[model samples]
Target: MTDSKDLDQVRSEIDTLDQQLQELINRRAGLAQEVADIKMAEAQQARADGAESAEVVFYRPEREAQVLARIMERNQGPLPAKNVAAIFREIMSACLALERPMQVAYLGPEGTFTQAAAIKHFGHAVLDVSQDTIAGVFNQVESGQCNYGVVPVENSTEGMVNHTLDNFMDSGLQICGEVELRIHHHLLAAAHTSAADIVKIYTHQQTLAQCRDWLEAHWPQVEKIAVSSNAMGARLAASEPGAAAIGGDMAATQYELQRLAENIEDNPDNTTRFLIIGSEEVLPSGNDKTSIIVASRNRPGALFALLEPFRQAGVSLTRLDTRPSRTEKWAYVFFIEFEGHLRDPNVAAIVAQLEEQSILLKPLGSYPKAVI
Candidate 1:
């Protein structure tokens, strides 16, 4: 038999800790409210002084990134670092909401992975607006209908989101932050579905490709259909007989479907990288990354001329992608991502050199690297 006195003592300690945490959280919220009031006053003063550009923006991506990083760094816990950071995320979200609720747009119809990424980066306190297309997400943010937008940029299993990359060519929105999500696809069906009766499978093209091997091995005879989003696949499967959808656990749960198989992806460590888009430029948070698009002249060694500056400066390049330039035939625009903020001296020099050599150079924005 368990010791009743010992159990009671432990429970009492936990209760005390919970009460203390609640009190501290509320105190933090009160401070956030005061900060908001001060910011409003400052904005009013700026307007009165005829400073048209000085607007009060509550959401600071760099600051939030630094805070999350500090929380992860200081963690010495029985619980995992991410779990602790996630708890703090909700606390910060609630406090920020006390200042002002943020509105974020994402590629979605709800239950999509982009929506999950938005919540992960912004926390659940912000309002989430779902758009049917990547263009829609960008357009909403650009039109001031939403403060920010989250869109998939690349996948570890798949290479890159071409549409998102292309959209950056014309959009004026900035890359404010980023989030990486570990994707695990599940084979889900409705409650009444039977394995033997399944004749068609539904999923996003990327999801279908990710699980190509498994599906080919098990359900080779079943017809695979590509949908706009995984959430759409789940919705279709829920209403159609003898239909199964390959999607994430979130979609399965949202559609009330049963998981016939879990982690059916071809690769075990599949992850998708998402970018947060907004209008404001973020200040440096110590560790940062800058993304840019460069179009070189149509000549020999054009690419080499564009990249030589970074090599000369000994800057670390994280990613480089090439897309056809919409304005020029047989010419391409290179999307490059590198470490260090644009404000850094070495990085600034390198960018200046590249601008001198390249036909066109556009700095997307510099923001802190992903913390969680």
Candidate 2:
């Protein structure tokens, strides 16, 4: 009887805390709406003054990054810092929706890792639209059909995603943010199917390669098939009786499949980096990365010439890759990423120096480094 009374008292305290939390969240939402209103009014006044680009932009990646960083910094939690920040993210996402609804596009048949990255970056309140291809994702954002798009840029095991890089060549979209998702491949099948019943396994070609050794060791006799995406493979697994698919958690849930095995990728540290493309440029978040494309004259030591400026300016280079140039058959363009915003003095000086040496230089916009 005493234990039951103690349980009831704890439950009562929890309910009281929940009520207080709900009130605070609503109060925070009211403040967000007020901020939106003020911005909208300011934008309207600017339009009256003949400003062409006085549109109210509600989503600020840098601001969100800073907020999340602060939240993590100040946490003294029984709950993990990341967990607390995530709860705040959904709160902010919901409050932002009260201000203005957001739409985001990602490459998908609906259950791809890119989609998961989108949710991670933007939160679940935003409407997520699925595009058939990476280019389609860019087009969606470029055309203003969606406010932003998420697309995979690189995989740890496979290197760069060339299709995503190619899309950046012609598109005017800016890189607003980035996300790094840990890739975990799961063996999934329909509820009625089991390991002994499986005849074929399906997954994306890249995924199949990631889990190659594990697959060879466990299911040696099973036929493996490559599909366009893991989500597609999940679809097949859901429909076919004797088929299983290697995919991530989202795919398993989306297709209502059971996980036969978890984290089957050969490389345990498998991670994929995704870029968020948008129409607006993101301001500096203290911690940021800038991406650019440069073309140099075909000559000896051209690579050194391009890289010398960054070294001279003391800017750290994070990534450097070469892509086939669309303008010249034999020439290639350099895709460079570094650790500073374009607005920084050293970064700006480096860009000026590169402009003097390179035939073509294009700034792809600086963005906040991934926080979560």
What TM-score goes with each of the models? 0.98, 0.97
Query: In every candidate, how many clashes are there?
Result: 0, 0
> lDDT: which candidate is best?
2
- Tens-place lDDT digits, model 1, residues 1-372: 464568779899999999998899899999999999999999999989999687899989888888888999999988889899999999999899998898999999788999999999989999999999999999999999999999999999889899999899899999999999999999999999989989999999999999999999999999999999999999999999999999887798889999999999999999999999999999999999999999988999988888888899889999999999989888899999999998999999999888888888999999889888
TM-score of candidate 2 versus the correct structure, residues matched by position:
0.97
Q: Assess each prediction's global lDDT (C-alpha) against the native.
A: 0.93, 0.94
For candidate 1, the 10 contiguous residues with the lowest summed lDDT are: 1-10
- Candidate 2 per-residue C-alpha lDDT over 1-372 given as tens digits, one digit per residue, 9 for 90 to 100: 544668778899999999999999999999999999999999999999999889899999999999999999999989999999889889989989988999999989888999999998889999999998999999999899999999999999989999999998898889999999999999999999989999999999989889999999999999999998999999999999899999999999999999999999999999999999998879999999999999999999999999998888888999999999988899999999999999999999999999998999999999999988
Off by over 4 Å in 2: 1-5
